[model samples]
Target: MATHAKLSPSSAVRWLSCPAAPLMERGKPNTANSYAAEGTAAHHLADQCLSFGYSPSDKVSKVLAVSSKGIGFFKHDQPNKKDIAFEYEVDQDMADYVQEYIDLIDNIMAAAKAEGFFEQALPLESITGEKGATGTADAVLITDKEIIVIDLKYGQGNQVDAERNPQLMMYGLAALNEFDVLAEIESVRLIISQPRRQHVSEWTISADELKAWGETVSNTAKLIDSLDETSDLTDLFAPSEDACRYCKASAECKAYAEHVHRTVCADFEDLDAPLTVDDAKYDGDTLAKMFERIGLIKEWIKAVEQATVDKLYAGESVGDFKLVQSRGGRRKWLDEEQAEATLKAMRLKVDDMYNKKLISPTDAEKLKKAGTLGDIQWNKLQDLIVKPAGNPTIAPGSDKREAIITNPVEMFDDLTEA
Candidate 1:
């Protein structure tokens, strides 16, 4: 078996939605991006802080490197495949965000300990009987009646909710399986601490509910394994925005392409027909439907464009399209100090070469928290802070913010003023 499972918990949402995704994504190259690398680095920092009971700020200025063998706080000289490695510097921003996650864990631990004897579990490994249904949890705290499994999401993209989340459910199942022997666990609390988004989401479910979900997971795994090389997968794949967002085969998947086509070119008679603007007057209902599916459509378009570019780069022809140089070269000083010195030697004015701007209100609040600004000064400055009314934009009805209402009297007053 491979070290990483085919039905990994991280990809649980995708695979569970599109049952054939694991098989279809075979041999697809999994490339790394800077965002993923940074997230991994943040996870490593959090792990270190939790393990050693040190502040994330303590690791500031330290380099976290990843080689082919695996990630670690190692030197750059470590040999690896293709001499390839990624390094991330521990910065103040990352430290602050990770400290929030650590603080959340500490708070949970304090409360759990107050209740009774609580045992903390690190690196909760999967012990499931189902093949390829393994995962390792970030942290797990087990008490007499409850188990808390916390997952730290460093990505600042879309906010991740914890309710009925497959990844967290898998982690909850693993934690229960690993530590239920020690404690009589009744309920599992899954927490997703996304410090980067400044959002923490949690959900609690009974232990029996988690085990029942586990059985469904096992059945899904069995369904996935039953597929042979010659089996038809037409009905096996179900594509949706969340499921197809990170699927490796999304670029070339026929079902996904068809889904996007239908989503964008709705009201058309033929699903495979070419799209044209002729007689295309979309109704309000049609427009709303398209808007809802716009994210998936945009993702599919981006994936197709990237795939074309990759093929072109690999000496393959993508119709009449070929790679061209883009207007992306923006020059910068190679050495800031040397450039400044040369500029000064040329009699350049200091004010002409430098920019001075006021710190933002947010940063000022940070200074106040850090004790750099006195309470009186901060209070005085608070009077100068002005927040403009946000512009109205489209949002779903489920949004927590109340709808902005334009009062008829205020509208008449504005018109009179005008």
Candidate 2:
């Protein structure tokens, strides 16, 4: 009998969200990063150990015994293709870190067991669909009450929440049919585990809702598959600035390259605009103040420019800025070493004076009896002194850090509040 094809939620989302992403993923099977591979391996091992009591073989287990303590690892079948090989020298540190991660898996599994809602977890399974469209889910949890699907993310980007997840629901639909437990499944729970941050987010939806989501995914996949070569698919996937970071074809994508170039030119154009001066109407004090303001503005502009250059070199964002003010003249401060030496010569350790405490009669008696004030001992101290707070001295064209506006509406409300 021919096996029926299955369409997973992950592929569906990629296909729907960014048609280009799925194309790239399918075309490049071995292009996944180490983090992605590690996450997959960890989740595979976890599901095996939790659901079927299958642990890693002794040799693989030994390798994992020393990995990162917080990260986990388990060996799957060796890759059919080798990417790289190492010489036969033992690296004890690497071995230990690997084992640490292996142990972390045990800890995570233990916690999952303690929760006691699920019966067994299953590792990755290929969900084949029509026209060669297919994908694999990280893991699936079988429970008396519900089916839970999990996706492991090694990246440090935004957390994936289930309410918006199409992949988990796709897994739910496939699993429900494959297990013949459509009626038994009360709901489908999707979880995203971010190992680096040690965080997990779960979203749950009813079986009916999952089925509906699956249909939507199927319809989307069908739509993409149905498109002809002549279709102008530009509107199918909109170009986004965030996608530029990891998009495989970003360098060659005309939309992305043009967008970036356009933005850069626009910014330069804005900066090059002429600055006008109106000095004819000013008189005496007004003229002097205006001149001073212009000087200050010039200094501020210099500072902002320097900051922008630094950020650009550092691969950081310098969104926008306007000059504010500049201070005049030189400033000096006492050297820390000189000040500390002088204070020591006067028979005073900075800590002693800084932490001197006056106790009440009852507290004093307690301290004397104890030969110490238990909680009064200064454990740690550091000095943070700010001087000349009005304006900072900086070179020309130096950029200053700009403040961010988090909630414009909230700020407006606050300003108008009675």
Candidate 3:
């Protein structure tokens, strides 16, 4: 089966909305950063565990080269084959993340069976959605009357809501087309399992409604196909904070720049001049307005900074700023196994050389559930746990948490100290 990158379910939410991004990002370098490598490795690990029950050894070779400059693992004649060639190497941190993903799928399967949501046992692995429209779902549970699509997200950067998610909806659409179980799937269930943030978001829609959504996705794909390769699409941008955050061409994309600048200027136009509050204590209302715009502004600035670095690396200067390393790279032991052997020969206790291990609250909870820790022990362990209050965050007044208040004198004292 073949798939278009533009129609990929993972990128559907962004690309469908910002129709210009697909072409805009094409001209940029396809370099893999540390984060992308880690994510790829994590996904590969999850796939291995899900499909073949395989796990990597502690000293296994890295999947993606630390310095590889090519786009993905392979450059096949078929565009879809290019996606298959790339598999990331998993480090200990990535392995832990992969385990969380595995556990979530296991739980979802168990819940489906226990709740009698499925007629047969959960499939050994997820089934592909409509390749032409939605790409593939991570896991699919087909019941007598309903079909469930599950996705595992390892990144902790954002909490993705599963409600009316374009990607999942597309995945649902794809699943409906490919699978024809006995009961006839009447409803489509979408679940996004994000273990890093300890979130499992779920949403569902009728099969008819999902198919209706599929028509919209099909139309979007058709629109993408209809674009003239020689023509410019700078005016068709549907820009947003989430859409532009990870866009490779965000810095140079004219539509994105114009959209942000125009929106910001218009929103703040009626405000007092100078854009800065002259008062020692800014009013809550003014700060609230600033807060609404700050997040988007910060996202735009970060994208531009990264894009600037990428351009400079390719010998394209960003005005007066020249490219330079921020700091020297850290040195690592060339031979870790030999280093371990040498350390062992030196009579250094393992305890002295390695840090003490401690599991997180979530891990402890899992262990307790597995009966590794008895109820009494678990209670004692829970008693030892301490959770510090989170630092004050600036959020909308409509937030559920009580607004943190500060005394005027304390505020002044802090300002004087600054």
Candidate 4:
């Protein structure tokens, strides 16, 4: 099986817009963290459920080993692989979350069956198109007239939408190309299932539209493939918030840094010059425009800081900065049992030996998910859960949230009263 495609559908948004990203990101060390490993485990859990005809609950408490090789299954007790990143014991929370995704697939399967679409496939791994490009559709259901490609976004950081989503669109194109011979595929439906975020978004496009988009994708891929390591991609780079958010090369890429500089500095000729707030340029309209780029600027700043730390750790000199241990670390018991026994031997009271506190509402919700809390009991508990109004934050006009209106007169009166 292909480990990862050069122009993978998962990174279509990154490459399609910023064609230079593929070459720029090549050979960079992966910075994946525990969250990524957890996501992989969750996907493996979902796969096991679908393939073995078993619910996630059935595998509760089972050990899931995630490594550089792949996810380990049964008999993973004694894994010989030394590259094991981490092993996750399937908990009720994980099982329940994976079950939500399974439930979505089950519902889709049932609906497809009703529509006379009996043929189905879990994880269309060989959905190849544009020569070197490929994608894996989490689940696919097909009929004579329709094809459904479902992708599961295990991450809950940003809410993914199906509307004009390039990743799902690429998946749709790949799925259509792969399965067109099996049926008269007229329409392709792209679905993104994000169980943790309680989001399931889907969009449908005609086969003609999907194919047309695929042609554009093919052209971009061919152009990128034709470029060599020495090729200058000055014009090919397109920097945006979504495209640069998870980009591995964002910190070091000259083009990305220039883009950020241009965005925030605004016509400042020296891109590498130190940033300073020019009071003369702080007009109302200019400030308003700058606010839009604030998020991107913050992301770039964070990326640069992280890159500096990573370089220092790798023994690469970055200016005069040196790595040092952080001060004021939290304390932990060296041996909890031994400490408890010693406390008991000293005739310490139970209350004195241990600290007890009520669990938060979030913990109570976990109990509900684990089936430890019944519906009625959870409902009663929820009555005590208070959610205060969030402070107003700025967002673009296109944001779905209602704009908070301010009353200067009422505010002044309230301040005076206070």
**Which candidate has the top score in lDDT?**
1
Better of 2 and 3 by TM-score: 3
Q: TM-score: which candidate is best?
A: 1
Q: For model 2, what is the error of residue 101's alpha carbon versus the real structure, in angstroms, after optimal superposition? A: 11
**Ten residues in a row with the worst lDDT in model 2?**
378-387
Q: Which stretches of candidate 1 lie over 4 Å from their true place?
A: 74-84, 114-133, 268-285, 362-393, 406-413
Error of 3 at 350 (Å): 14
Clashing pairs in 1: none
* Deviation from native of the Cα of residue 161 in model 3, angstroms: 1.1
Cα lDDT of model 2 overall?
0.48
Task: Report the C-alpha displacement of residue 213, candidate 4, in angstroms.
Answer: 0.7
Decreasing lDDT order of the candidates: 1, 4, 3, 2
Q: 1-418 in candidate 4: lDDT tens per residue? A: 3345777777888988999998889888788788888888888888877877888877888888777777865364575757777888888778878888888878877877623121132222333333433455677777677888777788998788887898778767766777789888899988888988888888899999988877787788788888889998999988887788888899988877888877766534344566666643666676677777777788889899999998898999998899988886789879999988988999999999889999988789878877899999999997799989988877667557799988999999999999
lDDT of each: 0.80, 0.48, 0.66, 0.77
The better-scoring model by lDDT among 1 and 3 is 1
Q: Rank the candidates by TM-score, best first.
A: 1, 4, 3, 2
Candidate 3 per-residue C-alpha lDDT over 1-418 given as tens digits, one digit per residue, 9 for 90 to 100: 3444444667777777888777777766665566666665565557656776655333144454322333332323434443443455455556566677667667766766622221112221122223432244667777667778878777788778788998788777766665645568788888888877777888899999877766666666666666676867766688777778777787887777766675455435453233333442446665566567666678888888887887788899689999766787798799999988999899998788778878898678757755789999899887778899999876555444698887999989999999
Q: Tell me the TM-score of each prediction against the true structure.
A: 0.87, 0.46, 0.70, 0.85
For candidate 1, the lDDT comes to 0.80
Please give the range of 10 consecutive residues that has the lowest summed lDDT in model 1. Answer: 116-125
lDDT of 3 at 51: 70
